[model samples]
Target: MPAKRKLKLVITLIGLLVLGGGWLIVSAQNHPSSQPAQQTQAKSKPKYRTLTLDELHHDPTLTYCSIIYYTVKHGKIQRWQEVSKVSLGWQIEQYPTNDGFKVLVWPDMNIKKEAKQLQPNWFALTKNDSVTYHSFIIHSFRDDMTATTNLKTIVDQINHDHAAMKVRQMTPKMLIVKHKNSAN
Candidate 1:
């Protein structure tokens, strides 16, 4: 039994040495510092931005947050597709929410598509006095954003566009737009 054990240990050591030698050869051939051989060989990347939905909120002059709820038509409620709502947690990331999900936040609500609760008129907001934000029509934007903006950019843009919007806001659904300052 001891002889058999010794023979097995020897075989294992030999196997390990062979593997190590093979790895060293391969490592030399494929050096860690090797750069791309040609510019054409480089892979093109997917389209996306470094900014996350959270960073959009920190804009001091923020407008409002837009939460996009994705619906998958998969049968059997099989996660009905992956819903992406930027709720305030418990991001199992599946949706059809009732657990109270909050995806977007903004100082102003600018949406392209028509929404039921949205009101186009500017809020004469007062604390303790119900300034009911009945949803607003979400305007369409590029594919990059669910809506036109996350929140801060919307507010900043709104601040920039407020003057023009005042004239337009004479009627409902007319967005509050501010014209660019001449100095700028």
Candidate 2:
């Protein structure tokens, strides 16, 4: 081969090698193996369990509150908002007798911390009434009567367990009660 042709061939081969090396470097950076240990672990472990209806109904120790009313348009039951415990109290007081589907929720305990972590907000509108809450569940009833009935049933059941239990309606839709025994 001519010397000029040989030089051209060498230069082309070098260019191809450089391009191939650059592509490999870029791909390695994007590979899952390239991710930090913490990120890989986080992706594998979920921060919270998805709330389910069965878990909510069966777990009485779980602190939760409900808003009883009938609404013309029903919203997604899974949705949640951030609010102070006090603010929730105020909302209950303000709309004691609204008519719509009943709304029940197990609010998140630390809204700020949960928000910072970028987790889904499932906290109820109320404050943390008990330390036992790990996650929250929210449900909406079809009508006011059904909600009221369920609320009464729940209150009665709680009272049955403790004779000294005093249940008070904070709002037409909200109830706040505590067992007389602190140990309970």
Candidate 3:
């Protein structure tokens, strides 16, 4: 009976040792300093920097920019999709409304047909308000509003008017747009 008890204790200790060792190895691998240089570089390769709206406009090299919307859930990106693509040359018209400015980005003729936002992609940015509100037309009552209502539908699911949106230039061609309100 004593021999059996000794054997059982040994087995339990061995199992615990194995588990502890495995945990250590995993933790070491996950540690930043222990990670390979190549892996670290890969993680930070496409370095994204915040660019002002004025900078985005002044950059003549920028042909066009795509509005990519992403939602983070459980500390992971759950939904990601390209919502709208507007040419850099597209005229940004601002109409003075009673409350704020109705900002409309008119599509350029040279814009690719595939990247066009067929429906009105107008957004409102409030002025002289205590809490600045940003709103955009993200839906249409009629199906005939646009050939592809998918973009609007997707945008509607993710964002609301209360959240503010900002533009960030990635590369000479790529643009990363960040909106405060997202479907988390």
**For candidate 2, what is the TM-score?**
0.25
Error of 3 at 46 (Å): 10
lDDT of each: 0.31, 0.34, 0.38
Count clashing residue pairs per candidate.
Answer: 28, 10, 0
Model 1 C-alpha lDDT versus the unseen true structure:
0.31
* Model 3 per-residue lDDT tens digits across residues 42-145: 78884434333344245422212212221211112111111233234343434566664444444442345475545434344334321121223245353222
Query: Candidate 3: misplaced stretches above 4 Å?
Result: 1-83, 86-89, 109-119, 128-166, 170-184
Candidate 1 vs candidate 3: the TM-score winner is 3
lDDT (0-100) at residue 164 of candidate 2? 15
TM-score of each: 0.18, 0.25, 0.26
Q: Sum up the clashes in candidate 3.
A: 0
TM-score of 1: 0.18
Of the candidates shown, which would achieve the greatest lDDT relative to the real structure? Answer: 3
* Higher-ranked by lDDT: 2 or 3: 3
How would the candidate models be sorted by TM-score, starting from the highest? 3, 2, 1
Best by TM-score: 3
Poorest stretch of ten by lDDT in candidate 3: 72-81
